[model samples]
Target: MLCYRKHSLFTKKYHIFKYDNEIHLGETTTKIKYTINLTPQTMIDWSINHQTKQLNGFWLIWKKQQKFFLMDATTCNLFKQTLNGIVTYGKHQILYEPIQSLLHSSFGSLVKMKYLNSRDSYMCKTIQKSLQYTDDDFYYQIEILQSLNHTNILKLKEVYNSNKNYHFVFDFPEGGSLADLIKTKQLQFKEVQLIIRQLISTISFIHSKGYVHRNLKPEHIFFKESNNLESLLISEFELGCRLVDFQNKHPNCRVHGYTAPEIKSKIFTQKCDVFSCGVILYKILTRKDLFDHESITYDEKMMLHLINQSDIDPQYQNLLRKMLQFNPELRATADQCLTIIDAILERTPTFSNFLDRFNLDIIYLIYL
Candidate 1:
């Protein structure tokens, strides 16, 4: 038997009975027994478990040769619902109810609440405590995300404030992140091109609003399945990827190799993001760590040495040098990178050319 509790919205909390095949509704033990075929169209049936006297949360059950087996419900539902959507290949699936939340620290202590609905799969990060500095950093991140709209940039759906926290909800990307993908292999040129284009577009959108994503790294860029073909980048905002920790208020702030030299000297601007973008670009292209792994501290000297010694394509090397210039004024801007990429596309035959060679339009549609 299955019991159901009517909750907010169209969501129903249901429980299952093992002995008697019936759906229990509220206090009445309704004898109505209906077997619903598990499919994408089926809503989660949640109810209270009479035996345990606790909520028998929604779950998926399977029958094999007259034996019944039950597993976590949300996992079954998420798999079915996002069957056509993006998926992480080797990462562990994080399972939790809609009410579950996690506490994280970004500059100060914060709370992240996950929105579990199919359409509204998002996470809301809220500043739970403010110490030493003001709330300007929090407000800045919120304002920057709220002002922009792009496929690459994580969309800020809404904002709320309470005495304890300031919350901002943004879109969730299920494909994990660029950092995770990089662990697999060096991205093909076409994939890199697509990623760079999306990144450029996101940076351009941010610059147009007089802000910079100072913390532009692989982890900050999320990946999601765009369609049946390729993955999309989902940039985290609202202190998730923003330079919240490195704000002017904090005298001692750092982001290891991704931080430009000028930024180290307190001379920072939007170009700082471009510098970080260059490091990220080099990392994706070479599938190498920006810095050495054995060092406990961020070895700036070693990073500089590697930057100079790395044998890369002359064109790419030139761009990297320009981006990492010690002088802030000498560094390339996001707009400049876009133009350079356009020129590169025009002058250089790309993997797209190879696609043309094979007449692989389907592959092109999948990636490009």
Candidate 2:
């Protein structure tokens, strides 16, 4: 129920009604007026925003362009609480019902879901927390995810806990993982540049906050929309941790080719992440897995030879070499790589046009 109304002149007060499976936002049940079908299954994107005259605003967009706004924080908060209650305890209480199982492993499965009311798709990762996670470990993970508020990093929207498993809800990238795209598309040079720049910038942000994403690979890199490389996102945080200024030693995580060589000796740091990014860059440019050979194994010499033979610009190759250096101390840092990438892009004549089309810094750039 709304205590504040946008049109106060009307004597009828605004109200919200929730049935067993649907939610209604209008004046009354007998005489209803709503922006759209208000149900948990409808695909609606909503947010709270600042408004003029010392009021907070709530806005909703659904079915593409249709929008609704309520210029009061109290109303929005109340509405959120109401929806949460229905989602948590209603008859069909599974707010995000699983639509498909995307992946399965010994630990758990990653399931694609559709929110019952809004119909927006989401990816839900179920973790068997009881087997390996303590109470502190669970809460600590939630805290870390909450703290990491970045555009490129996957955002954790909701978390649910059962007796044996923990369910985490994240925005689903319809475009799928970088690995999927690499299997099909041979990316152009400018596309490679755009992807790598965003990847390094995100890594730099994560390092600045004293954390390291131990698992940084093509499979974990996702595109928000299909065929839209500029909408890139990095996810899968099961191995990420805070470094506390490199004062503590964290456990090593190994992915065949993306893992830094130094990690093989249990010496891991922020530089390891940079090496992973470099591996991804190589994969994007060459459309080949760096070390995934069945019969013929790739030694460092062979790998270097392959990189040299690739068609990417020499500048990127040189940067990749620096990033994939065996010595941790000699590896380029995220900031340093970002600087080189920026310089390379700036030197290009088409750089300005590129920015106008694909700059992630401009928050309003949308896919046509």
Candidate 3:
């Protein structure tokens, strides 16, 4: 790729080329002839500015520590093309080591994949390519994942499409999904609170961005560390839909009980997401699926018994009531729920006393 720097008299040329399948940039001048390797992680930002609808040269901000490259139109296009095919198949194998182990294997397989050159590991989600999934669908999910930037949300590093499958490289949460945790042991009240707080905060962010995560069950929630329940991260956005796109039409709810009842009418909104969170909170607290036993028509008496169970803390019970309100308008907004939770936590001193009296053997979930 071609790059240039402005000198007092004229522009000095710099060149970027491939060496041993790795990209390199160096100045042409003999006095300062130097080359540096550039990888996918090195490219921080690349953009071509426009002024009043007119094209301008692109500024490529890449760094090992701190480096910049300015490329003209043709050079920028070439660099982009190189990046597009940088990790197609053969290069993907070269960059990332073989899959270490399987994390989940239901609809698709979630495997632990590590980098060849570094100790860092990531989860690779492999989904079989079928006619059911189109280019537009894949791109839309990519756009949504790229748009989200949050601490409690799983990060998508790269996407690879092979002949038979599509690979989504994601940050590996060592503790695994919340569902995994639930199947092993009952969580402390404080742990449940921490998970709910993080979930609501991230959900607030998602709603602000005009998107609703129709599915928010335990399987979609993960923890960043095995020992730290507070290090939670939410993942899986396949059922997510933009609010604007659904102004006139909406898809059916994918997660049966977790989604709000209004979704049956093909209506979805930010409130519906809040309702799903309410169901998750109920699940974590009671150690039971909210609608696991319900049929096409829910058992209203049983559902109410589960919701109004006396064992759940009164503060959470109150919050659940507002969140799980039958009418969408009566339901609490994520922001409102967050505020309520904050106040509840502040007033409840025992909220901080996690595992003070319970035996570690009784509460801890052994991964092995």
Candidate 4:
């Protein structure tokens, strides 16, 4: 929970609760933080660097005048940065960077640090050493991920192998993840289609490079800090494995809907990713899971029919059928899915679905 008690010189106050789609003004001493909700468009002008994981620049409105302040995570103190100097609320001299709050805790908690300089801000991801992977295996995986140069994949800057855990350094994104966004906003069709196209292309690139993403879903997908949808980055490559010399065990996907039917059988190919993407496509369009999130209970007789095709465009439904086919061989390959995505984008005139928009081109963008 975010907390702050107003101090002298800080007559005005604003507290921001961070999320993926939108940041909300949770509480303020003034009672009115913002007239309405805000996105990156509304936050066009700001002095703070978006990349800093700690509290950044934010805006608040009071007495018909707009005010801005930079947040200090250490003491929950707010400061206004101006051309002349900084106007602080509390006894603010100089604060050395401190370890801030944890960004995520479940999937191996990631701790974010407050940076004295904007460039010093970074994210630390620590994983427990498991029996499946040895020191050499972890290093090999990191090596593969480091070699992967793609805009859609998360960058691994440095890695440290310790006795108890493996630590990785990465640039922090301002926005959280697609999973975080979906919790609040019902994604529009056009937006979902665009995200789908980008992810499919990236997954296809991985397949072409002889690797399978083993896991592909909303939680793994992240957006850059500025809430730019196009800045989607897929992280968590520890589960990734090469197609040829596969060794690690398949991840448990019971909670996440993006697991393929063939995953349990241990007989799959690149099409497993197609199945996973298909699950995501169905979800964003309908906001309902193929199987219940709480339990896998589903009426087998009406599985496909339950998808509510009437609300979705026909092309999406058709694509879902191909990708979600129970037979692995019958499912669409990465290239085939890419073709369908291209056709859909070409047909829909209004949507700016830049189908082949992955920059890293005709010869680019793959993940671990």
Candidate 5:
């Protein structure tokens, strides 16, 4: 294929060539004419003066539009030697490395993809379900997730389509899920506050946007650490939806001890997410092993009892009690939780904090 190079307005050079019938022209700051695609059926005509090597002329008529572009004399001569009816350049094909290792298969639809850049990577999510549901659900989820920007929510990179599943790529945080990170140890008071603050902020933002997370659990919260600062991120939007547009009053709720009781009565509200947050907080505060799956098999009712039975520090006891309240109306909202967090943060940490006051070195010595 004939190739041309052009320095952008900023003088950054990029290879301009036709690939798969599309001219892959790109630079970091381009806002227009990024790429151009033409099918085999496309009618186009162009010629270059053999000596002058300038674009004598070119124009394409496709459907109702006629388009034309000019190439300077310098560009014309640059590709003249290999310009053999636009087919001489060797074809470049993309190869996929076989997925030999999988980090997660909870959804039974994960394919480890190639690493992309220094700070980002790609993983394929294959989604397959009954055809009864319209494909629009995928677009709706994308719309909501794309518009949402928060530290706690994972960022979606892009999406791809296949015969069976809609594959998604997300910005993978290096530090895995909270469930994976906190298995052996409990967090200090300041760490817990930082994590809870992010969760509360995430829920409140989504609620304000008319969407409900519907599923909230520790596993959904991922950990990210950089420059000695830590961050918590929420992932898995498979069940996320707009509260106003959602028609299913009784959608199946995931995560056993984390689900609220009102879900059984076909009642849905933002408070449901708050309840799940409470379950996470209780687990973090007490560092107790949550009731197991076997309990779920015997009776789901135990989950309701599990939430209320957590004996936490008295300071947070009142806030947790309000958050995990069995009655939907009595359940604390995310905004309310934020207010409580502010109050907790404002107060001096003595007995109120989950962790005892200590210098970092002393605390590490104690734990070590």
Candidate 6:
């Protein structure tokens, strides 16, 4: 049995009983029993919170006695206080109803309020169902995030779990996604080069941790600032993109035309990311969709198709062919890609050489 002493914050005295991995909390001893999973700290956190309301998803103050605790109505009963404080569960009331309404109408997805930070920004996400509801997905996410620390990868702040749901809180990036930017025709060649480098570095990190980002597409690549070409941010990990997701379980990877042949056969590895990277590079270089017929004009498609099918530019064609290899084993590794990129960079002539040949202002801009 776990016992908690009433603090100055709460006026009532509450005693908690624990037996057989279950805990009971009430104002006084009662014959009725409610099944609950409790750690010593969970009951302690609940005892300190003066406010307890049904609509406000079981309330509990996490920090108490210099320790953190997880508490909800199921785990423990709440004690009443003389003063009333706002507490209710269910869907949280958004202070900016207009914004919430707009998002709801636009997305038309069920958004659950997860957490409210010190900045008053609410963290919310659409609920998703998973085949494995246990800690498999949760642990996989934690392991992947902890393994790779890069500017291009999305930042996960924390995770919250209740009896009915799980929530992931992440650092919000204002720039939207690469997919959106590509739609606006804002991505340039130099910007694409930078983005690809960052992405390769991130993929290298993931591979180092023995994981493959099965789903690597423009939509998954988030941005920090909408028009900022240098912005770096990424998000979305709900899919089976982790090592555990692929561990001994064969599932066909999905990413439209970006998916490699090995992925379709359910034999994916780090090299699959290289194939996706090639597709992304093709899009970046031409600023046209490789698959979307409506987005790419006939002339653009003809040009890209020709370049892809023929050796018009041997060097570029070689690189593209190596990346788009049908077999995973034949594709380039992250380290190999890095080396190739370095070679390409070294081969690129300086602006001074161009100026010497054509008497151009390119050298001045480069020097400046």
- Report, for every candidate in turn, its global Cα lDDT versus the true structure: 0.55, 0.71, 0.71, 0.63, 0.60, 0.53
**Cα RMSD to the true fold for all candidates:** 14.4, 14.0, 12.0, 18.8, 11.3, 9.6
- State residue 25's C-alpha deviation in candidate 3, in Å: 9.1
- Tell me which of candidates 1 and 2 scores higher on lDDT: 2
TM per candidate? 0.58, 0.68, 0.69, 0.63, 0.64, 0.63
| TM-score computed on alpha carbons, candidate 5 | 0.64
Q: Which stretches in model 1 have alpha-carbon errors above 4 Å?
A: 1-120, 132-135, 226-254, 292-311, 350-368
Considering only N, C-alpha and C atoms within 3 Å, which residue pairs clash in candidate 6? 55-88, 55-89, 56-88, 56-89, 57-89, 175-226
Q: Model 4 over residues 87-179: C-alpha lDDT tens digits? A: 101111122243665555544557664445554666666766766556655665675585567888888754544556666656776788787
Q: lDDT of model 1 at residue 208? A: 79
Cα distance off (Å), candidate 3, residue 177: 1.5
- How do the residues 48-88 of candidate 6 rate in per-residue lDDT, one tens digit apiece? 23343321213343333232233443333332110011111
lDDT of 4: 0.63
| By TM-score: ranked, best first | 3, 2, 5, 4, 6, 1
User: Which of candidates 3 and 6 reaches a greater lDDT?
Assistant: 3
Looking at candidate 6, the ten consecutive residues that score lowest on lDDT are 80-89
lDDT of 1 by residue, 135-194 (tens): 565555555665666666766654444455655555556676788778876676557767
lDDT by residue for model 5 (76-122), tens: 43533223222111110111222434445544365545531122344
Error of 6 at 235 (Å): 2.3
| Superior candidate under lDDT, 4 versus 5 | 4
Model 4 scores a TM of 0.63
* Clashing pairs in model 4, backbone N/Cα/C closer than 3 A: 174-225, 175-225
lDDT of 3 by residue, 28-137 (tens): 43334444333332323344443422112333434334334566656665565555423332124434665676655544677787864355788877766665554455
